[model samples]
Target: MAAHEKMPDFDVIIIGAGISGINFAYRMQERNPELTYCILDGRHEIGGTWSLFQYPGIRSDSDLYTFSFAWRPWTGKDCIVHGSIIRQYLEDSAAQEGIDKKIRFRHKVNKLSWSSSPSMWDCDITVNDTEKMSLRSRFIFLGTGYYDYEEPLPADIPGIHKFQGKVVHPQFWPDDLDYADKRVVVIGSGATAITLLPSLATSAAHVTMLQRSPTYIASLPTRGVFEAIVLKILPSSMANRVIRLKWMLFSLFMVSMCHRFPRLAKSFFLRETAKILPPGMSLEPDFVPSYNPWDQRLCLCPNGDFYAAIRSGKASIHTGIIETITASSITLASGKELHPDIIMTATGLKLRLAGGIAITVDGEPYNLSDNFTWRTAMVEGLPNLVLSIGYTNASWTLGTDSTAHLACRLLNRMRKRGLSVIMPRMTAEERKELEERPFLALSATYVKEGGNVFPKTASTAPWQPRSYYWRDLAIARWGRYQERHGVVEIGLVTDLSR
Candidate 1:
């Protein structure tokens, strides 16, 4: 189909109807009720990660109180909610907010190109399992969550094809694949593996967790006193403060536990983990993390299910590199062979920007790899494109909520000022100063490989702001409505016509 031949449907097109996209749609509607909009999701449903992740014992690692939309408080007492419940909540939110009508399911966006002449974007989209169609809009919002699709099953393993038993990736788990009374081996140590181990152990004859490197794991009560206080005393506007206080204490303890006393920290994790296991079972260091807490994602055990599975003698931990995979067994580098009825690879996901859509300005391709200064949520040079990247440590929604507010504020300012687009202008020297800073060096991949070209302030965490909710709240508030950092410049055509 010709790009321009596809009908232009709305003023703005939002990709992915996940939390970010849903919230963006709500905010945009609130701003202009009559403005036309359409939300497209590659999946058949609205909930992005929540809907895609069907592994057992799947739940939010972050607290639910602060993990949700600021406008809607989580009424559930459990601070960490399960995947099914979370998916339900998202569906309810869409229904209650009347945003479901705007969503187009099973519509995947394949390519996006911007025309400088019209200052608009032409998006190539596939809908209803049909041939690709075109969608043009004034602006494009990329809400495609960071974790794109399912984790890829390792393809390099020798004789992997010979595995006669079922081999699955957690991202693409089969609905009817039964693990009951069957031996299951789960590979990888990230969140998905941790979540899958305990759940499968409940029914599986035996389950083994294999990890190449150790990962930090922490356990906390699903419900807490501070959470109660926030529910009672704080309004939605002030809830961020309470969340910040809670996060501060938690982060501090995590840092100290991992850094000050490594042995003690390891012991603490093992001890707590041991509680869930059967009386005679032991918590091995092989499953525990070697890196400092928060260096990578800290695995969460919401209700000690992982430990419980181990205690019941249904699960075991194996730490070593995999040598090869046979039809019914996994051979480790140490010559240990694990026989399994099912092998679940919980490996990580591939990171793609803008839903893996290509971007072009004035028919010239724009490479995000070439730009590196991320300001607020806006890429440095990209106009009319805003990204939704969630928090690394705390609640993912917290960052997105704040980013949504800031984005709305910026958009409103531009409209009121009669500006079409806004771009941050950093000079060669100022850009150089930003480039030389060590703070920006932490996320080398995000900068170097992810094509995340933007000017970022020194104050953001899990990267710079310390991952404390309180510190980030302050930074978010300060930058939320600031117009100076992100200023609008009239396009040449608009200025000339004016």
Candidate 2:
């Protein structure tokens, strides 16, 4: 007879092998080479969200330098990269760093249970929608984005089912969707709708962008002069740093300029937009947004492609309320009808927490709103959990890298101190007294539609997202992280000596 010793699946578990998870894992593995880890994603491959979203002309809204990892300098000439290119970059990086071998794909986590008796996480997963798998780990890093995977938010239009041609959402774009030499109507004016308009217009007989109101649209050259000048003198890596700093500062200045001189900026943007519109087409009553710039995200069209589409008479913009969708077209409230061959609803995403997994700590289910975020990584009272969401205002990867690196630093510090558990122990008084704000500060339609159900941010340190990229970079990268302030603590479960 023999007694067998059990072993956990991994020393650390990071969910979703997207850019965020990959970067965090790299940082963690570099800091603690002894720790064994696994990366799990519901999808059958890495690239997480990028792999999930497949649509025509789908590309990053943010520039590559800011959107990519700080260490990975994007040497490509195009600042804005296509989704496939971005996906490949992630795949190649993971392969080069040996992180690809650690990924367990097709593992859809259904629940997560954190136990106190033996501090670890029980990650319940469903494989290929049939098989059940249970894995355990000492730490759980959730790189699962806030967007719901099941479906996009319901923006029910009258008679959508009656439409006979075709209806598509960018989230689940069919591989066989064809609109060549056909009329198409794209509903909504967000980034998706904006991207789709020019893309579909290239082959489609005509493409119509039908929106209820307007969203702010801005244009910049595909490549910046600042980057070109720096790369000429500096090495690619150092040139990247110089370009990123200048770009970041320029972004901050633009944001400040928008706030202080809204009218001046608004006038300039509309003027630029008017340059590419069809002759005598007023930007007002169609392109001009009622809200201020950066209220919702400003749509970016590289090389003025979106504007050039209209200028070439390949596309049209209609700002009117939709009455309903008919068999082959849409009916506006103004008694106008748009007969089109295809319809695309770019309504927005359905926001969800932890990919809608049932999470419990010590047998009690937790609500996201009940816990304030501690430095955008850990939630109040949640032990050994790090949320890897990105910035709403800046490049998503910028925030991702900062949060990932900071979490790695904390994990390394705990190992050095011989601590088994680390948690942000919030004071009850602080919880009651601290000013509460929405976790996502942006006024985007997606956030407005589905973000209320998620967590709330605090008005103070370690809880509030400063929203300033430079200020946050300093705090997350080099702040004096201490537990004596009573915000967070590290614990030794048993005897102090090993």
Best by TM-score: 2
- Please give, for residues 326-362, the per-residue lDDT of candidate 1 as tens digits: 8778999899999999988776655565666677777
Instruction: Show model 1 residue runs off by greater than 4 Å.
Output: 1-9, 31-34, 150-158, 225-284, 425-430, 436-488, 492-498
Candidate 2 per-residue lDDT, tens place, 192-219, comes to 9989998999999999999989987776
lDDT of each: 0.69, 0.82
- How does each model score on TM-score? 0.83, 0.95
Residue 309 Cα positional deviation in candidate 2, in Å, after optimal superposition: 0.6
Candidate 2 ranges beyond 4 A from true positions = 1-7, 480-486, 494-498
Clashes found in each candidate (C-alpha, N, C closer than 3 A): 17, 1
How well does candidate 2 score on lDDT at residue 173? 94
The lDDT leader among the candidates is 2
